[model samples]
Target: MSAGTQRMRAAVWYGAKDVRIAEMDIPAAGRGEVLIEVAFSGICGSDLHEYADGPHAIPVAEPHPASGARAPLVLGHEFCGTVVELGPSVTGLTRGDRVAVEPNYRCGRCPRCRAGEYNICRHFGFAGLMGNGGMAEYAAVPAYMAHRLPENVSLEQAALFEPASVALHALRRAGTTPGTVMVVGLGPVGLLTVRLAAEREVPRIVAVDVSPARLHRASALGATDLIDARLGEGVGERIRELTGGEGVDVAFEVVGSESTLRTCLDATRRGGRVVLVGLAQEMSLDSFALVNNEQSIIASVGYRDTYPELIRLVAERGLDLTPLVTSTIALDTLVPDGFEALLDGPGDQIKILVDLAARSDRLGSPEASAGTRRVRPQPGGGEPETSE
Candidate 1:
């Protein structure tokens, strides 16, 4: 390695509230890898859990069993970038291809991975959680992890595929398609679910949220009806009222709080499906209700093979993420002081984009490269693309 390949800048977390925006090595792409110039990275709610609380059930600094990345590590899983170089054994990918990464880097040899349930492999680990994800200027990922975007997708829109895939994965788990579904909690995941349901032509979407800001955001994102859980009124009753007193075909528990969980149970119809996707504070379900309702409860993990479709839904059909993205900041804002703002900022913000193009002049964005892609104005509560 040359001295020129010494280091680059990254925001690393040593421990709780100990993340430092310091310089680290700009990694070289090894065999079967590709070095990507990260264009945009979204700060996840999961990252907040690690920042505000303890080590997110993942202990202090160590190399991820999957990616072999050790701590103090860079923290960001949701990001989009372009392939600048490919390592030996990497094929069919080259420079300047805009792509979104699948953050789950599991050992393909594991039982679950071999069986096509790679999300739960024995060596299962996430990009930001277990290893160095896309927070840095450049990330060397497996060549296979790169899913190229269509000519229509922007880098910032592509960055959203990571979380959007999660929602799609959950909706698939719940078998929710073209039906009246109830999504509890209008955070990033919940809001995405509402939009996905809308795009999929789901008839009625009842969005439930404690925050009035989130309720308004949900309504803006294609929710047919909104219920303010903080109104201190019975949320389940409102959900039932919205659903014609029959409850919904499927219920998505996006908020893992105790009260939200209860509302999830109360809002679903008999023999309905309940998809538990969010991490819970406390998980205890009543045995009596479980037997009586006979609800098919499904717990979905990250995702499996949904990136291409997720991107297509946004790029081709023009999914609306603008309402979700309440703020956008440059790369310098992602460091020292920006970290706090990312954590403690407004609840109305569904998504916050880190513009890598503004920071790295040499490494340009996917949008800036060709100028062929175009985003049109959205319809009622639909998406509108970014422009100069």
Candidate 2:
């Protein structure tokens, strides 16, 4: 690592099943950009999909149809960091302030951004997905994307703002404000949705999951009712009975399975709103039945301008995600161990954080691991070193 050039390390996604930790020089914050020393980075479901499959968020091999980012991208978006450096001419920000990053780098000049709907920006891309992300020691992000973290929140907790915003956006899309709510899928986002929905003044949250362990977590988080999908074939029947046949007013689908999508739609009341926040291969629905029932189905995409509200709400007492946090590891464990844990046993696990400064015996110094170095085709002939 050069003294003048701080080479930061990050989990580089080369391709499907080919993720390696690579070192890149600490990037200079361009105009309107701020450099952050990442404190913690959380993993999301989409990240898992990218790990197991291809066509990752913010396309790499091909320019993202939307974000315009190409392959060999750094993989991380759910993270929180502190501003250590600011770009020239940037204002209203400073050093040493804790903050959460809203990863989507939308072309601010686009029609959607002009209309304040940047999530659907004609050109949208998230930090870790679209550009270099917080999986590294230092990340250069847009100044507008950073939100100040409250004093009471820990770095790990603030990292959740990304996923929490995803759920909040889903709820906001469903008009899920201050009322009865149903969250199907007990993963990180589902649990965060419950916690945030409570802060929104929703009196009851009924959670459904296939894992009993998740149901227990939901109960601890104030879920009034828990349904174990593994033991029952009639989940819709159970939900209807639990709600006294009125059915839930709003349902959030966080499980990325076709069946869960159908279940979410079925669990909502005739006139209720259902927010489809999950990403799955396919879902079959009868158009006539959906229209005739007057059911409002909303497909909430990535968060727009909602990180500040999430930070504020999370700092409040109503939504405390501290308990939902499951574990914390260093960045070196991200590709090898962290990804394994997330895939093998994410049941009941709400959030996992990668701490930047907390180096363990497990994570070696940046240059010590030859195992993480990459070998690539040299020019037009042999392979070459791709890392420090």
Model 1 TM-score (2 dp):
0.87
Model 2 lDDT per residue over 217-262, tens place: 8888778888887745588778888888878889888887778767
Candidate 2 Cα RMSD (Å)? 3.4
| Per-prediction TM-score to the true structure, in the order listed | 0.87, 0.90
Q: CA shift at 323, candidate 2, in angstroms?
A: 1.8
lDDT scores of the candidates, listed in order: 0.76, 0.76
Against the hidden true structure, what lDDT does model 2 obtain?
0.76
On lDDT, the candidate that comes out on top is 2
Residue 42 displacement in candidate 1 (angstroms): 0.6
True-vs-predicted CA distance for residue 294, candidate 1, Å? 1.4
What are the clashing pairs of model 2? 60-70, 60-71
Q: Candidate 2 versus the native: TM-score?
A: 0.90
Candidate 1 per-residue lDDT, tens place, 1-388, comes to 3457655655565577655544555788899999888988888887767766758744465566787766556788898899888899888887889888888887889789899999889988887778887877788888878998888888878888888888989988876373678888777888898888888888888888778888887787788888877754488887887778888888899987666777888888888888898887567777699779887778998899898787777777777565677667655545322456666666556777776656534223442223212223354624434332
